[model samples]
Target: MKTTFEFLNQLTKNNNREWFQSNRAKYEDSYNEMILFADQLIEEMNKHDVIETSVGKKSLFRIYRDVRFSKDKAPYKTHWAGTLRRAGANRRGGYYFKISNEESFAMGGFFGPNAQDLLHFRNQIALDADPLRNVIESNDFKNDFGELLGEKLKTAPKGFDKTHPDIDLLRHKQYIIRHDFTLKQVHDPNFPEIMSEAFRKMRPFLDCMTEMITTDLNGIPLV
Candidate 1:
């Protein structure tokens, strides 16, 4: 991981294709390191949670940059990232981690849920927000993610009441729980376990939201 971090730090300075091509060996080394790290992360995740993501290098996202649409056309990514999905239809939410010199974090939750899912979440909050509140307001949740995050509308979201008690939770378009890591933290010897523990803390919120989204307004299972 340290070697990977050093490689990414240099990548920030030399983002051009020419430099990347010239240093392909370094890139490969860093990539392999990330793959090994991701494999270990999956092992750690499965100890406390059911992970559907494949083991080994398959868990790691490609380092190549897609320059077709973006204005910044750097040929390589400056960080190594992996995403893990919880196993089974009943299990909802995702796990993500990125290692970089600039920003590194272990994040989980509903990133961009569909309209139907959003409606269901809001309905649950409107009907009874105690369960959701209990999860987010828990000491472990507060210590880990600080608070529920992601984009929100300033005003009421369509039919929801502006003065509703749980309007703050309903206004969210995305429910994201994140724990950012400092460079020192990323470079720690036990970073894989450390990051996995951060992800484990999201279970309460994930379980709460999964129940909300998987059930109808009548409190029956949808799947």
Candidate 2:
């Protein structure tokens, strides 16, 4: 199997839509390969008894990049990205798993300036320091991302004041767990074991999110 690192390196070199069009066959081949990789990842998670929404059954992969408003204006992306939505809430909300030339991550909750709920959800994350701390303190996180997090947190974006009323409201709202790691690092043989350990440590938070979503949806709980 080609590691994500190899795929990403090739992707970065030809990120333009025209290049993608000319190399359409290669793109299709890579897309099919990534679908298989995602399935393998799901199978690995299942072996560890981790419960995740069904993504493998359907071809959830997407090669297009929606850039109608963005300044960069790249209509297509060379990298493949995909998301595994929760069973019924594909449009409204669900976990997002993305891979790109730069990095790969599993981000739950919402994002974008217009995604009010997601932004609210992100704010809620700041309320409890433990979860965030747990992610930051993990050996994998420390070894790979300690410097990046330290720099970003030290100079957080404007209007994220801890004392603000919006911030307070977020503190009370239900928070979702999101974790990201660089694709290059994850492709390492030792990385799967590290990621599995991290996931196990974060299972309680994941369970909490599943429970909260179930209660909110009036649906059966995952646990």
Candidate 3:
């Protein structure tokens, strides 16, 4: 973990093709280390939660940055990240961790759903807000995530009244939660357990999103 963070820190300072190619071996090592860590996290999480994705490089994100349309135009990314989700799940959200010099966090939620999907999600909240509210309001969830964080409309979304009781919940453009971590904690041997617990705390929210998105073939039936 320390080596991984070190590599990422140095990468931030030298985010260029030349430096990265020169240090390809180090990058490979860090990549493998992340895969191993992701595998371990999968095992630990499975003890309490069912995950569809298997342990391997597939679950880890590529270090290369897609800079085609980006203004920064950095050829490589400064951090490595891994994700775990149900095996066949499309884009319903997953458990994710990112390692970087500045800050690292464990996060989960339905992120940036398409316009049609977003409407369904907001409708789910408008119709049945208690289950989602209970999860986000729980002591463990609050302690871990602090609050539901995501983009929201300035006023209310389409179809929902401004005076709706759960209008606040219906305004979200994304459903996500994050728990920050330090480099020291990432290097701890118990880091896998730490990740598992954090993901566990997020299960209720994940489950809620999963159910809302997967059910109702025509999209969350307007209720």
Specify the highest-TM-score model's number: 1
Give candidate 1's TM-score. Answer: 0.94
Every candidate's lDDT: 0.89, 0.49, 0.82
Mark the 10 consecutive residues where model 3 has the least summed lDDT: 214-223
For model 2, how does the per-residue alpha-carbon lDDT over 80-178 read when each residue is reduced to its tens digit? 555544344322334445556566665443232234443433444544445444554577655533321111223333456766533433333333345
- Which runs of model 3 end up more than 4 angstroms from their true locations? 87-92, 214-223
Pull out the clashing pairs in model 2. Answer: 110-118
TM-score of each: 0.94, 0.55, 0.87
- Write model 3 residue lDDT over 63-163, tens digit each, in one string: 88888888989988888788887544533577788877787788888777899889877877777888788889999888889999888899998788999
Off by over 4 Å in 1: none
Q: Which scores greater on lDDT, model 1 or model 2?
A: 1
RMSD of each: 1.5, 7.1, 3.3
Per-residue error for 135 in candidate 3, Å, reads: 2.0
